[model samples]
Target chain A: MGAGVTVDRLAELLVSHFGAPADRVAGGVTFEELEFDSLALVELAMVAQKEFGVEVDEQEFTPEQSVAGAARLIDSRRAAS
Target chain B: MPQAMPGFGVAVTGLGLVTPAGIGVDEVWRRVLSGEPTAAPDPALEGMPVDFSCRVPGFDPDRELGRRAAWRLDRSSQLAVVALREALRDSGLDPSTWDGARVGVVIGTALGGVQTYEAQQRELDSSGVGAVSPLLVPMSAPNMVAGYLAMECGASGPNLVTATACASGATAIGTARELLRGGRCDVVITGGVDAPITRTMIAGFTRMGALSRRTSDPRAASRPFDTARDGFVAGEGAAVLVLERNHDARVRGARVHGLISGYGASADAHHATTPDPSGAAAERAVRSALEDAGLSAHDVDHVNAHGTSTKLNDVTEARLVRGVFGDGVAVTSTKGVTGHALGAAGAIEAVCTLLALRDDVVPPTANLDSLDPEVEVDVVAKEPRPGRLRAAVSNSFGFGGQNAVLVVTRS
Candidate 1:
């Protein structure tokens, strides 16, 4: 966990991990809006674990959540650590 | 209305394989004959819920097929392409000369693109649907293996995929054999490919308690028909065989590996996952295969058992083997060495058994330290046994009570 992680970095990581476009994962874009299925979510979690050294439990997140919301949660966890 | 007898028999002209043992049919056969076990404790899976798995070693599809092509294909499809290419090469079937509509492709897979699906799930959870790749749906589909193979080899008669859990591979071959026998296709590339060794699949199996937990002794973990066996070790690989009508093969002057004498498929309809403990369904499947071959159980010289290494499967299969082949048949479960390749297990073992007939040897069942007392059949263990194998029967039983048996003999 680190404070240096930016929204841009998060978007890039999402694109790199999911093979999606960065603009499609913007602040207001929800998981469902982007058509992110369960399989895509798991890939995102694995990439997050590898890159950010954080484990994102599948039970904690939902399709209703926005990409910005997930980034904020990761940022807050980084701050707490 | 009476159906006319089948026109022609299916002959295996060439074979290909990509397994934990090695790549290509020759390499896989050599390793099987040497009694080698490919199960190993992977530290990458150390903290994971599933402790043991039979992973293909040093298989980098990108290195083999280039990055762009590898990216488009799942691990299972990659394995299938490699195997299919080898089989086509071995058969000397010039794709340029063959009639695409007269050739067929059938592939069986228990879990296809599971790894890709899992990866996509991670993306969906973190980002959203926009992150999902357009190729996700096609790549994750089980039939895509056959689709890819058909496209690669120009097989257009019947492109099909069978997904009967573990029996999928054998069922695929059986379907292809029927297609050939009915005079629907002259050549059919048929087999099984599975790469279900994903984190989620392992976790699910771990939760189900269907995987071995002996992480320290990987080689000794998968002891099929042995008293110490607990459960099967998950494996990933692919095996494909080129089947042609005997007349077509003769006309082409192709070297015939063996004849697919008969195939019998049955369903227990009793359970979704666990097999029928009575062994009636499995016995019927074996007997039907023998009958279809116009041979009795006595005609069978070697048996390639399903042998999942699970306690219940071992007992039920042993009873079925005894009921079919009696006490004297030389039987071996190659899953002891190859582990269970899920959908690909039966097809790969079928090919192995075919090779045993071709080479006149019984491939040994590795890691069987002590025979389960309840298993009345003769289980080949340790070193490969020399034998005059004329006709061999391979059994593949899967979840949802699906059972398939294939009888193959020397040409």
Candidate 2:
């Protein structure tokens, strides 16, 4: 949230924290495309809150959303707050 | 109908052990042969009443299992999956080519993913319900040990977890025999696993006075059948055996490690935690197992007593063995070397029995300085005894008065 919450920063978090394959964690790939299940998404939500200090609803963090899209949402939420 | 091969018991084609003694069948057997106790002080139990335990040495989940898989599974399931892979490979059965529906999985566990449950409960208490893991139920459920193994091996047949306390493993093996005999499946992957060394679990057992508190000398804590023995040392591990009908194993040209000739189970109907002092119901299971194998007392060569190192269990088990097999049969408790693996104890002992049959050598019960005068059975101690061991019985009695006995024969 402080620095812009870049797509690259989000990708690093997924790969390092979530055991997501490095090759598969790209900006254009949707979470569903990356095979992140519902349970994983919920866990990701909790991790994101702690890491970025921004509240993200697990339900709203849709599987169809791409990693880049997620970064933009976090950045927008930070600006609005 | 499943073809019945009368007088021919199910073949134990393969065995996989991840135990406190060491990992894999050969490593654990080697350590057991040396009579080296694996118990030591645990940093996690630093402040507890009993600060030591027997842990599976050098078990790295992230390295043994991939980070992706290990992160999702509980410690118990991780152990089961690793052991299962070994078992399947040893059985010479390729899951990719085998009929998935014809393979079954049965796991026995006294406590399943208890560490995970405790951690999640702590998270809930401190960080509210929202912070709790969504994977908690699937990861910590008592049935997930078998469920995860089934998923790992693509086994679609009968899959369930048996939870009869300490007798769970023996009960699982017996139930797997029934599945094979009833033609439920041609191959059954069955065993027991438990990682119950959490602070809460150790504390609970400590409260029950079920653990050995010889903190000064951790290695000498689990002294089965010895007069100076106090109680069992809590441990964690897993053992899996691939079971197939004798004819099926022969047809496939699988290497038969041994045969689970007979299995018997009974309830004491006596007490919750205390084994029947009379050893009545426990004897019934032993006699029934021998009878089921069409074997008499004189036919058995050795006895792998449950021998938990606890006074009640060791004394009662010794009396039962002496009552059933007289004075000449060789007896030993591997628990003295590996510590008490609780739910995994039965299966681990069964594998040891098979190895004993294979090599015709009975490993000594570690830390048995002086045998109890009341225990009249011939307990092999001090060193491993080399002899002709044809058939051996492994006994497992659990809390809630549950007793399970298995009769294993050299193939």
Candidate 3:
């Protein structure tokens, strides 16, 4: 599941889940720009868990953080495991 | 005991309600007093497993707010925004005159945007992410109501959303009171809104056996405190109240409808979905509210009960009411008409209680032909009960054993 989920797919999921425009949701966009509140972050984590089989902790995600950071973290975790 | 803070009383200056009973405060009161059950098998929910739901009548938020804005918001958020707009307008507080930093918004919701989430999920599953709407994420979060209200009203203070199930609304109002009492805000728009009558939500509640199966007779389905009651009917709505500090209201020459004198909240830490039959925690919540108001059981003349019409909730809430106000005080469950509004129940019931205090009339618990023998409270039924109501208590007990009680009195 980890190998199957790429940065582009994560970006797509972010765009879909956060309802942000796809162009604005690339690796550079912050969660705050997408209006991702705590509840949405929790739901996004659930979606990530269901789609990628990777349980993402909501607390670990920062609103100021970009999608690329999440992708890098997921990739690093997958490689380490 | 610690000395009571000076200028701590918070008065509800304006109220806005969007319920199955009706939209706006007066309309809701009118329908509630008429004892008309608004529960009906929604055609929108035809394919869903749960048959009966209490949907708001003629609710077109776009009529009040613009269509483009309504399109981006979920029903829950739309309800909150519209209700808050009415509440602010009723309060006569021009947002332009107030410091945005001193105004706050707190809204409570139970399931957030289950409908929007479900719709987006269907799209994601069927047509992939490209088919999902752009507003799906912002519209689905529970806190979006609070965020939207704050943005709409230009409130910059501590904006929050409480999700304590049914108690969420009362809790939101209680939080507003604290914020005003602490001098953090001069005015706070607080309440609860929920639009959870979605196919997935109805199916979930039905699967859990929490919804009434009396689809043929929706009006007779939600019989709170009645012996024939099976389970609660799902309802969608929101209620908002504008709360200001007593001194601030007086300074601004605002009409104070009623004072939110006290609020008490407690968690049973019991079952997630069932209440403690002993009703110990709920009793504590009621007692604590009374104590906070510097009153006794004798002072409360009316009670807005959290009678969900479920077998356990009705019995347990009745026992708690008896324990707090004794069998003498008049008790009524608005859910009999509103059909268990989940998270918005407390706030909507609180508004009803405030109106009852204002009008000196208690709305009846509709459809209660025969009272449950296990519940001994004086359940007001059939018609509105006229009385000299000075102080009224509204109880909201949610799932997760969360209990909140609010005491409102004539200003």
Best by lDDT: 2
Question: Can you write out model 3's per-residue Cα lDDT over B235-312, one digit (the tens) per residue?
Answer: 989999999887778888999989999888999988989898888988898888888887888989999999899889
Candidate closer to the true structure by lDDT (higher is better), 2 or 3: 2
Quote the TM-score that chain A achieves in each candidate.
0.77, 0.88, 0.79
Positional deviation of A67 in candidate 1, in angstroms? 29
- Across all models, the iRMS values in order are 7.9, 1.2, 8.6
TM-scores of all predicted structures: 0.83, 0.97, 0.83
lDDT of 1 at B235: 95
Q: What count of clashes does model 3 give?
A: 0
Give the winner by TM-score. 2
Candidate with the greatest DockQ versus the true structure:
2
Model 3 CA lDDT for position B371: 95
Name the better of 1 and 2 by DockQ. Answer: 2
* Candidate 1 Cα RMSD after full superposition onto the native fold (Å): 7.8
Q: What TM-score describes the B chain of model 2?
A: 0.98
- Kept native contacts, as fractions per model, are 0.00, 0.43, 0.00
- Predicted candidate 3 versus true structure: per-residue lDDT over A1-77, tens digit per residue: 45335678888887554556666777777788777776666666656656665646667677887777777666766
Candidate 2 accuracy as lDDT: 0.91
Write one digit per residue (lDDT tens) for candidate 2, span B47-110: 9999999999999998898777887889999888888888888998888988989999988999
Name the regions of candidate 3 deviating beyond 4 angstroms.
Answer: A1-81, B1-8
